[model samples]
Target: MDDRSEGVIEPLPIRRLQESLINRIAAGEIIHRPASALKELLENCLDAGATSIRVTVKDGGLKLLQIQDNGCGIRRADLPILAERFTTSKLSTFSDLTRITTYGFRGEALASMSHVAHLSVVTKTKTETCAWKAHYLDGVLVAPKPGQTVEPKPCAGNDGTTIIIEDLFYNTPTRLSALRSPSEEYARILDVITKYAVHNPKVAFAGSPLPDLSTSSSSETSHAIRLLYGHSIAKDLLHSTFSSKKQDEAMEEESEVDDRESWKAEAHFTNANYQSKKMIFLLFINHRLVESSRMKRALEAVYSGVLPKGASPFIYLSLQINPRDVDVNVHPTKKEVHFLNEDGITDQISDTLQQALASQSHSRVFEYQTLLTGGIAEPEQSISKKRKGKERARDGDEDEDMENAETKTAASPPLKKTASQYKVRTSLQDRTLESMFPVINPTQIEGSSSGKGKPADISKSREIKESECYLTSVKTLRQNAIKGKHKQLTEILEKHTFVGIVDLNKCLSLIQHSTKLYLVNHGALAEELFYQLGLRQFGCFSRMKLQPPPPLRTLIEIAVELEETTAESGLTKPQIVDRIVETLVARREMLSEYFSFNITPTGLLESLPLLLRDYTPNLDKLPGLLMRLGPQVDWNSEKECFETFLRELAYFYVPGPLCSANPETEDQEAQDKAEKWQIQHVVFPALRRYVVAPKTLLDRDVVQIASLPDLYKVFERC
Candidate 1:
């Protein structure tokens, strides 16, 4: 052929396609596979106000798919044209589309099914005495058998409707071939039903071929989630509900009519504790399941800050907007939809859910634990080397250091602390405070001259001696604490999320419990913890031996010198010193036997009782503690003496103000950081596990700062 002949193409005359072929092509656009057909039928059942739905599938719905619902049945006259396109009871005029709320408005579901598959319907209204059954092929009623009349036949049935589709995609072989295996198709069917079940928890649903796919009516969203998903996902789930409403610019113009721009959203999402490799997202607009890649990406971005890398969260979000504001006819299968204020709505929802997840104690605790455990364990030498490198990088900029630390934590997997790991154990057998917050490097230690002493051997393997005496006085003190414990405060401490220190000089820290934020005076809380430990341990206190024990008289002299500057007393400093030394020495045997306060025969203060593991009391406060024991105690009464003495010891062990008040120098800043690390890691974690916060702490130590609901109300008014 010549080049001119090849380039000269003739246009064919246009002609209308055959009606049968035209209907078949339109049907293929709506019903792509077995799952698509099932989706349409399920929606039709729901639109009819069906509360209970039962489904049966064969060969993944390729061979047969049946659905029975106890809904308002069809009329006898409507059966003739029920499978015809555009014959729907849901709409009448063009304006009806604006306010359409029903799932099926196009009325193409049954008609589409008829063109590609064998379709039939069985129905009976409440007013009718019996049910009627009809069969259809290619959008028209057909005879059930050869030479039979082409009309509905009366049958026995309940007051409902049943739809059955046979040999789906039999005529459209290409669509059928594009589908997955039977098991895979079945899995997709189950997934669709599960999401609908969670959204419409009040409606009952049953799927045959497996018992696990059934859900009962009158259930809650949380229960449905727990039933369909595993308990692991349910336990770590977070829920949030948000809405948007435009306020009238003029009060005089405001009417009683509802706002057309208003929209509401409800969501159930997993927290940081629950993570998977792939995201499980279910989005429904106006109760119709749909997909929006923009919305999905927005949600995934919200969890990125909380969950580790390569992990995602499970989210179920349902949005209800004014029908006039949403365009439901954007997709042939109604799977993808568009609405007004789509970007604004997505942002509002993402923010609300992000706030909810951030407030979860589980997520906060998980992050805290990750930082403490360094995510996964490693050799001691390796950890030290890595920490050294980080220290150099974190030297001058405190905020940058925190940012880097959080980035590392966000990249690491969550560590689970189960119930078995927190079982109450003997002090000697328990994990030490130092393990959670390791001691600072030698350079930092050398920079501080205040409160300096040899840190205790806090290793888990360290051996120490403890008192074994069990006395009645100690038992009474323990019983009093148990009787006076506060129920609400106990729960709060047990599940609190540790926020960082608010005022390091005041020993004040922030913590979140449930949706409430609280300011905790950890210094005061620590005193209670140590006091309780002393009571419980009674004679079981671990001993902290003092090297080259100081003489009792010498300790008294130091106390006298410190007291001279602040005390206004009748007795002189020398007189006060002599009295305290004599009183303590006289009661040496009693102190050693029950309180683990060892005093040598030569009037030397040998050792002190260790109340908390790996926690050493400030040696600087020892003189003040010894001085207080003499004057504060009623030595004559057995109960009074033990109570006052233990109180003094607990007071001494409570951490004092940070040494570097200004933090102007490098050494001072390092000291502040080290102090903060110990309080956040060692002290707060111990309180979470062991202490039972009493009601007294509410007024004196734990102060409620804010609550989630209250904050929302304030913002709404603004």
Candidate 2:
């Protein structure tokens, strides 16, 4: 037809003739890009509980985006009209949208997709003897392709549906042009998959070049991540457990008691260690694939007192609240949602996350000692696997160079002491992250919310409510606080989001430092546990006999005052000793700080009986014994232990507990306490020094030093 004859006579847009074409145009409106389209289909498959998902993408779904599922398949009779607009089997009436829990609703995803893309529905009903194949164009049943007509053919297949979207946006060039590169597009896909993969651990997801797949995506993803890590992410890993019950309780408590709860709530407590992103999977209850600004801000606030100022986390939160809780009709592409309990949900989530995170215990085991010599290998296994894999075979010098370049970036790993830990996260991870999950990157807190210098103060951080996950009971919460006053885990105990475990080698790669244990949280785990346990519940009080040491006293003073103490009292030797003792006794965590220490989910603990075996009712009692025992004594009573600790603090002021002890001990208190502070602040890099570098952890004295730079060549060569 001539241009003049076409519906577009100049100004007004050209309108399609048939209703099917009209429906197809509408379909395009719903299914905007490859990622958006994939989101809808994936939702459906997930709702069906398919354990394994295989996603094949070409040109980011422009050429073809195929997803096959093993869920209950579709009926043959419905195949012809499946592509039609406003048709769905998930719900029969309009009321369903109010409680639409499934991923697909509005009956528009398939219909809208059919409009602009070549659609194929190959489905086999669970009861059907064979699968039926049908094709559609412009939301209407038609030949599979042009000029091809064959009745829906029977094919052998398992129970499920495979949806193929071909020539996406074939009708709209402008939209397609806005898409990113293949790697970038795939990144978005990976983003989508990652959110789903972690959210539903029961389900496995993988994506590889079509017809060129070998290993599992999780394995491949883990390895590729290793290549990008430049430095190991974690070491000293332990098992973890996550229960939605805690999340739900938190949700309910917020909605009811705190009045911050939402129309619906879901909590998740995972028993597995996560890599460094502080991973979170967020799925808003009422909306699909979107983020509310308020929600983000709310999340930030909840984590504010808990996480450091700049640090954030990788969270995959799936919220299932009343539809009225959120307005999904806000965005054209549905990337944003309006939440009802925006503040409530965010607070609940952040608080819950804080608690979940605070429960982290790092005493994870590695190097299994079996009668037959068997245990889960170290994370370096991933590094070694890289050398033996196809990546080593196919991606030669050029790829290595590119990776080296990526490593040099802010995210890359750098050279450090052999006994030190890596920097945790680098830019290499940032670049490779998208390849693993293309749509959205995982949450990262390093340099983001790391609570750099004194975040307000412990008092201010304590001002917020303690999350449920970290609390054993209200009384226990109170007891925990009392316990923490003796030690100083206030900074680490309050957040919920522990990074994954790492081995000594991996630990050295991630951080350039020596730390028997360390934690980076906005709040302290000891303090958080205090609130969770509700110390009031535990009437038994083993009061802190020790005072803060000099250096620790200064830090605590700064935290409390946000200013340096200029008073002569702060400079007094006796006062300095008091502060250090109190801080150490109170803040120690039994679980390993190194991420590689693997421990049982429940067995992982912050306190060990051995560490708490000694105490003293009176500080004077320790000195009498020091006179008899030559000052340095490992007391055995719970009460005497506390006193012995206090005596150390007294040393901070006057050098006496060690006066009768070793000749080098008098001045060591100040230096050691100062060093510990440096490690605590993350200001000093950690370093471990061994005599002769044994192949594994078993070979070293494993002295926890303050900084990597402190590692002597003797230590390094060891």
Candidate 3:
């Protein structure tokens, strides 16, 4: 070598790192500390389908960390290469990487730990007569003591696996030095366990500090959140489930979509009522605890409009995406992750939380105070100070001391304020869509016609059959509705103050919620509302009994005449009628029992399912519904049959567009007004009661027309 000490650059001889050194470096990347190692072990336990897990730690797991799980155990034959790198049962070929479902696939977790610490495993498969215990070091099996055989030894154990790690980072002093203190490490380990417990609430988790850390198996996610986060958060929690519309369409079309782009998410977040100094966010992508600052920041911004400045909300979100769209191999620890459509997904979730918060904010609690007698009241200066203190709180300087100061001020002479000063009243005439495009007032037409009986009787009639409630296909459809609900529109419909009909011809109406106005397409929303209701009340329908059963053949003939008048079909009129009559007569029992469509044995139409009260399916369209029930419904498959049948029923129930008949004509005017009244009183109320407003209706059915705040800004500029 040249004289390198003389300030002249010189190259040193190249040499490969020792195999042990190489392994130690790689191990450092995987197992940063005790917490990282515990995460890997926990994932392995969950992957094995363990329902109960017990974790033990000593000296914050630097000295010892043990995890025992009652899951499928490794076979004795596979013990020889248990710690070998690149050996795994989860994956086989390179292509398998695209669809890895299990927690461990690289086969490096155990090997990495072996290089940095003492690793031992005691595993017993159900078929095995005895358990096998093995010790590993540097990715190879090793003897327990000097002169002993370097092979696994049969031992007494339970029917699961138990892994023990000792002296973590023993061979890597640099990695060991980078670790936190024992107490801090223990806290980190506890946090990891806590989040995993929340995600997999059905799995029992038992960890040390027994009284402080233990969770029993639970089925309800809300119940689990209550147990872990406390009563405050749980009480204020709002739940929502959502998925890609592509997935919904795929189920209907029975066609494959790009799997890499499909995803679903479930979120439990605190409403405006619950607030904290810092956000407590737990995100699980594909059930693996991961972090995304972009998502966390986006969610935080959503709460800014609802919560006072400097306050945060608690959120727990679990996301499931196609494995092909995710690159879990990007990081050794797998804590930080990225996925396709992240921005879109984040925006959707944020919008959902924003609406939930907005709706909750509408219900305000009023505080009443009595002033002193004889005109004695709080000093003006005191009132001024109190107002300034609230201003600070609103400005984000909310602290305990300030709260205490405010409390102290409250003890002084109380201030008496009028309820009008506190009430949030809107001058409707000043800025309302109804004022611009006026039609019959929604409130004036309320109870204009004797609609169907009370909702209580309707609910009683819609009793679900216990047998049908548990059907897999029906549950999936119901879940799709829940997962596809659009939160903002749902809030609008649920709490909106009905404005008035905007255009009877277009079938559009206006409704106000808080300070914003929305134009709702009553026709489209009613169709979607009925569709969701069909799925929601599957196998349980209240019948709308016809006075006398009409002959099926007669209705079919009527439908044939109508079809011939409307447009040409693939089949002739007579052929279409025969097909529809034969199909209905074949499935009469199914129709009568599940859908409440009681058909007589003589092939005559009878009662129909009462989907919505106070609203009737126009008999004009009944023939069409009856005619298409044969060709449109997929009678071959149970799921498809129910889906297509419900769709046809929903379409039939949606009223036709408003009549172009002259408004001056008495009969036509009465019909148009009756339809408008039904929209406001029957359709909208039913929507508030049952419809979750799925994403399909977001822009198409409901559109925001004007906002009160925006109007004020415009006025100010003028």
Task: Please report how far candidate 2 places residue 413 from its true position, in Å.
Answer: 39
Better of 1 and 3 by TM-score: 1
lDDT of 3 by residue, 1-718 (tens): 5566777976789999998888877887888889889999999999887877889899999999999886788988888888888889988898887777777788889999999899999998877898999999999999999999989999887667999999998877877898889999998898888888889987778765432455655346887777666555786899988776554765859866566688888999998777899899999998989999999999999988777889999999999999988877777788877678889988988887787778776653332221111111223344456555544455444454545576555458864332211223444234444346565533333344235421222223333332358878888777777887767667767766667787877778877666566777787788887887777667788888887888988987976785432222234677767867887988999988778887788987779998876677667677778876875565756876787789889988886542266778766666776676577567776776677776655534566666543454356456
Q: Each candidate: RMSD to true structure?
A: 27.0, 26.8, 19.3
What does candidate 2 score on TM? 0.43
Q: Model 2, range 346-438, lDDT digits (tens) per residue?
A: 665666665655566433223312121111222323443533453345446766686667536676666422212212222212322113434
**Model 2 lDDT at residue 703:** 19
Task: Give the TM-scores of the predictions, in the order they appear.
Answer: 0.51, 0.43, 0.50
Q: On a 0 to 100 scale, what is the lDDT of residue 559 in model 3? A: 68
The whole-model lDDT of each prediction reads: 0.77, 0.45, 0.75
- Most TM-score-accurate candidate: 1
Q: Model 1, range 1-718, lDDT digits (tens) per residue?
A: 7656779866789999998998899998899888889999899888887777878899999999998887788999899999998899999998998899999999898999999999999998867999999999999999999999989999987667999999999988888898999989988888888888898886778766544576655579998997788555787888887778534657426754356778988898998788889999999999999999999999999988888899999999999999998888889999987888899889999988988987775443442111110111122344345544544454447645655676455568864221211222224333433445554554333213245633322223233332354567766777778887887788878777676687777778877665566777899799988887787678767799999998888876877786533232335788778878888988899899878899887888889998866565568778777877876565756776787788889888887641335657765667566666566556676677678666666644676766543453356457
lDDT: worst 10-residue window of model 3: 368-377
Q: List the residue pairs that clash in candidate 1.
A: none
Q: Please identify model 3 stretches exceeding 4 Å from their true place.
A: 1-7, 246-258, 363-718
Worst lDDT 10-window in candidate 1: 368-377
